[model samples]
Structures are given as structure tokens and as C-alpha cells.
Target: MKLKSFLLICFSMFFVVSTVQAATTISISVNGTTVKTDVAPFIENGTTYVPLRSVEQIEGLSIKSWNNKTKTLIISDPSKSMTFRVNNQSQSDSPLIKNNRVMVPIRFIARNFSSDVAWNAYTKTVHVAKINDKEKANLKSEDITESRIAAINIPIISTLKELTAGESSAGYFQLMFPEGESKNFFTIQNGIINHYQVKENAAWLTWSGIIGGNKNTNTFWVTNTDISSEVGQRPTSKDRLFFYNISEHSGQSQHGYISTNGEKTILGSKDMNSLNDLYPIPEEELKH
Candidate 1:
């Protein structure tokens, strides 16, 4: 009976592993009421997956896929609209199917619904909260330049720089690209900054340039700096520092360094990194 006993032990181990995977859940809400299901959402490589149809029906959002090669989910809400990868949270031009369930980035859903969403690591639950109409209107009315950095992903581990009044008058920030041939450019004129909004498959960040009072081209400058110099750069008479959020596509920089006539006098190095950092690479940007 030794063989029989060994078989029994192996079977028991398999059952235990299956039980753990099936234990994960997505707690959903309806009119302030929460509903928990015994059904376990699919999981792959640590990301919790949910059914697209189920999420759309309950959340009142419409999802449609146009390209046959790619499964796209579009939230037609006028207030906000964005597409997310079906399989990975990284940037994606298309979605994926895991165990027959359509996986997507939680942020895409949050942006569309004007809701704040976060993932609970221990519980593996995707939390979503809806924002009222009044809040939606207020956010829309805010100065676009004032809050442009809100939705963009910024690494939390970045350093902050301090700036002087002259520096603040002229917007001057530098961006670190992802080691590619891609180049970023912008212009500052008459206290106004104009630049392209850099975007990848799954995400995009702000790179808008600002103009100073004099409208001089020499007043705008950009550079890449080392983390060790972060502290030293912050105290300069015409320098500023800021820490960007982890989800930001590009890191943060201190801008608004201008002279009395709205001219750029100094261009310094400004970028820092943490020991352990996370940079989101949208998977969908690959197909495009």
C-alpha cells in the first residue's frame, strides 16, 4: 500500500494549490452596497483579472473592439475616455484574454468613470469608486496647465528641486526618455509653454513648454542630471524640485526659470532615481 499512500499525498498538494488561486475576488459595489462572489477572477503573473462584459454592465460603460488582431475596450463617456491592455497593466494598443476573461489596467476604468481606483496587494482586490457630476465639472474647469500633471504617471522615487522667482517666471523642465531614438522638443514664448503630450500604447505624459515675459528663445533650456546632484540643485537661486508619482510615464523636473526680461540664463542637470523603481511599459504599444 506504499504506492497508494504516495498518490494520495500528491493529489492533496494539487488540491491545495488550486484552492489558493481560486480564493482571489473582486469586491463590486452597487448603490453603496457591496457584492462578493465565490467565483475567483483569473490571475496571471500577479495581475488580478476580471470579465470585461461583467465590468461594463455593472459600471455602465460600453466596451468595443475595432481591430480584429486587437481586442479594444472603449469607454464612450464624454467626460473621460481611454483604452487599456486586456492582459497586462502596461501600455497596450490591444487587450488580451486570460483564461477566457478580458484583463485590463485598472487606471483606464478609473479615468473614464472619474473614479479613484487602487489595487490591494494583500487581498488582490480591484477597488473602484465613482465620482459625482459636480466633481467632474470642477476638474474640467480647472486650468489645464495647472493640473496637467494629475493623470500622467510620475515615478514616486524621483527627487524634488527648489527654484527662484526668476526661474518660476520661465517654465523650464527636462524629461528623461526611455533609451530610444525618440526625441522630445518644446518652445517657451511670452510666458506660455507649448509642447506635445508624449503618449505610448498604454500611457502618456505631459511635456508642454512655457513662455516667459520677454518671448526670447534663449530663455528656455533642458538637461539631464544625476541623482547625487539633486539636493545641490534645489537650493540654487533659480532652481526648483518636485517628486513625480509612480504611475507617471515620464519623471519630474523643475521649470519656470526666467530672467527679468524673460530670458533663460541657466540650464542645469535634474533627475533622480530610487533603489527599487517601477516603470510601466505598455504592452499594446507594440502592435502599433
Candidate 2:
């Protein structure tokens, strides 16, 4: 019995030590500059994961927004945008928090941001660098178009109809419209829009409209306000014009209902006390 007990104790100690050794700390460098993080990076399942905060240290990359309730993080570079959810089981490799710091897969970030990544096994280091001009030229035509689209600021509940019309390459866009008692959510991708209505707890196809504007102008036009439908069809009414004017001095975008006859009822105006500007809903909340 004494000999058996001694063997069991040794086996437990070995297993514990092996587990600790498997998650070895690794070094990370971005654009030839070494980045230091409060929570050290580690390798697991042949993939290197780094702290989320460490990624912000890279040039041209910053955290655009964070939703504490949903634990979602949005990161944007100059030409690209990426979204990640913390502890999202739906994703195979979701961002996780370790030592109170969020950790994400390094290779995933590099691929999304159009950066190059190399792993040095001998030194246990990961190097990330921006793609050179030659590499950028080799990228697919769709990629180039996406970079251009990313530069445009499309307001919520709007689509880039004028910019993306007739182009086969489409980017992901979110739209939210109000229904009878619930809100309808849609994601436009590759010229196809998928609808999800909150009140009915159902998803279906619906007709959508073009809500686009010129960047230099303060006013934009909205046609065919009715988006709720059971079948996919083009809207027949092109006369229903909803105009929005953004003031340059005040730097405020205001929405109002403008009839075809030229009568306008702006939000918060004395004529329309009940109308209010629609605020953007966080992506995390919309997804849920």
C-alpha cells in the first residue's frame, strides 16, 4: 500500500508540471516593434493567442467600441473593421479573458486586418507586419473594393446604394427599422438582405430601399419607407421622399419626414413634438 501511494503522488505531480509547461509564454512583435502586455501570451492547440489590449499597440489599429453587457469588441484599422465576441461559444475560437485581460487568436486578427504573420518555433515568437505594396497589388479585386467601401461612413439604417449598386462585390451592412410593435433587423451582404424581426421572433425576406447621399451635401433622400413584407420584391413607390439634413456648424445629423408636396416635419420641431432622432443600436444587442 505504501509503494502504491508513492507512485500515485509522483504521477499527479508529473501531470501538473506537464500541463503548466504546455502553455508556454511567447513573445509578440508588430511592425518590427516589440509589444509588451500585462498578461503574457500563450500557445494552445498549435495556435498562439495574445491579449486584446496588446493588439491596440499596433500602429493604425485601435479599439472602436466595446459593449460591456455583451462583451463584444470592435476593432478598426484604416481599411478594415473586425468584430469579436468574448466567450462566444458560437465561434470556434472566441476571445477569452485571462487574468482579467481579454485574449484573442493572433492569426485570426492578422488575416482579418490584411497583415502578414510568421511564427518562430525555435524562439517561441510571433511576428506580424503590414503587407507591402506588392502584396497589396496581388490581393483580389474584391479586397480592393472592400478597402474602399470601408473608408465610407454609412449611417445606421442606410445602405450604400449609389456606391455599391450593380457591383457584384458587396460588404456587410446592418439596418434597423421599426415595425408595428417590434424592430426589424437586416444584414445586407453580397446584394442580398436577410431580415430578422424581433417581435414575431421570425426571419424572412423583405423589400428594402435605397438610403444614400453625397458626402459633400448635408441632405440625403430615403425612398420607400415601408420595409415590412413577406415576399421579396422591388418597391413600386419612388415618390415617398424622406429627407435628412446634417448641419455642418452644429455637427448634428437630424432626421425628418418630408412629404413629396414639400411639407417638412423635423424631429424636435414645434410642429412634430413626438418625432425623435433614431440612435444606433450596438451590434451585440442587435444580434441578441
Candidate 3:
């Protein structure tokens, strides 16, 4: 009886350990910048799973549609397309919807998009990097210079007003920084700010935080200060409107004022236009 009881205890411990490993939270980074997601990624049976919406942020990948009746999901890019069935019990690698978020295999999706995916066991993190074909060809040439590489990495600066001038008015705008290769895309809808970062030739949704408004004044404050590391710290008050400009709907320096905060304040600016534009976000992204 003593030996049997010891065996049972050992089995129970093994089961608990396995369960913990399966549910381990995983951090995802694209090109090096860590991305924030509404539903955290996790590992199960040695496969890392991320939110399906997160996959849409990757360059050259788009979620076309998902049919509930058939449980079929269609994802495509300019060059290739793929389909998957959700919660297919017969398929171990099938995508699953949990807590209203569609979770898909990261490796499978990454490979389909021609992006390199790496896993770090120590940190429990997944890194996805998009391969630039032009960069590879340029590297092989002897004419490549340090100055040219620097110029290639430089991000184009543009204001929201300019980018969305001809399009239908929405509470969305693209903001670019002149300081670094980081381009920030934002949508100020309702009272929330959905922030996205463009890096490694792909876009990642970095933050979705609340914006505080003052009823007495025309100014509003961004509640979350730690939005982007590349842009550095920004003041919460109206001291400087980093990417928003109220007067002309143009991009402003750190010394600009915030005249409009809610809905009407989707401001942006442009400088030294480059092809490395901000990745487009889905129209229904915030709706979910």
C-alpha cells in the first residue's frame, strides 16, 4: 500500500507539471520590439499559439474571412493564400477560438507568410522577422555603404491629415517620427487610443489605452505614457503634442499643443517620404 501511494503521488506531480508547461505564457516580438496583445500567446504540445488577429499584423498577410457555419478561415497575401479550419479535433495543429479570441499556430502562420520564426526557451518568447528580398540583394553588392544602410532604415514622417486626406473620414490616422525608423499608427475612436508600431517590415499592435479628456478645456491627456520606447517618453499634459496637431491637422513637434483630443484629433505629418509606410490596420480591428 505504501509503494502504491508513492507511485500515485509521482504520477499526479508529473501531470501537474505537464499542464503548467502547456499553459505557459509566451511573449512575442517582431524584429526585436515586443508586441502587446489582448490575448496572450501560449505554448501547447511544443507549438506556440498566438491570436489570429495578431497574424494579420504581419506584413503580406491578411485575414480574408472566417465562416462560422463551416469553421473555415481564409488568410492570404499578395503572393500566396492559405485556409484553415477552426477547432478541428482531427487536426492537432488546428486553430482554436478561446475567450472570443481566435488562437492560431504561430509557426505555421509565420512559415506561410515567408517570415522567420525563432523560439527562446529560457525567456519563453517567440520572435518573428520578415525577410527583405531587396535588402539581401543589396547586401551582396559591394557598393553598399554605411550611409546607404542608415538611409534605408530611416522611417518616413507623415501626418494623419495628409495620409487620409482623400479617404472617408474615420477616427484613424498614421503618425510618423522623424527621429527613428519607428512609425506609429493610431486610431482615436471613442475614448480609446489603439496604437501600432511598424518594424522589421511588419506592423504590430503595441498598445490600446484610454485617453483622458478635460471637460473644462479643449485639451486631452494620454493616460498611458509608455506607448513606445523609440519615441521616448511624452508628457501627459498639453505641454507637447507629439504626433497630433489641432490647428492645421499637421504633425507637430514635442512643443505642439493639443486643441482637440477626442474623435476629431486624428493628426499626423510627413517628411522625406519613403516606401516603408505604416502598415494598414483592419477597419474592424477595434470593434472586436
C-alpha lDDT of all candidate models, in order: 0.33, 0.43, 0.46
Candidate 2 local lDDT, 1-288, one digit each (tens): 122232233123223334433666677766544577777888766667898877776556788988888889999998878888997332336787666777888878876776656665534557675634432332222342232121111111111121222223222222223211123333333233333322111122233332323221111223233222223344222232223233323434344443444345555311211112223322111211
Writing each residue's lDDT as its tens digit, candidate 3 over 77-97 gives 888788899873423468987
Best by TM-score: 3
Question: Global lDDT for candidate 2?
Answer: 0.43
Models 1 onward score TM values of 0.31, 0.37, 0.42
Model 2 TM:
0.37
lDDT of 1 by residue, 1-288 (tens): 122222233223223334433675554432222334434454455544455554563244566543435655565454455665354443433346655556554444544465544443433345454434443342243433212222122111101121111233222223222111122222222232323222211111122233334544332333222111111121122322111221112333322234423343333322323212212222112111
- Better-scoring candidate (lDDT), 1 or 2: 2
Q: Of models 2 and 3, which has the larger TM-score?
A: 3
Better of 2 and 3 by lDDT: 3
* lDDT for predicted candidate 3 compared with the true structure: 0.46
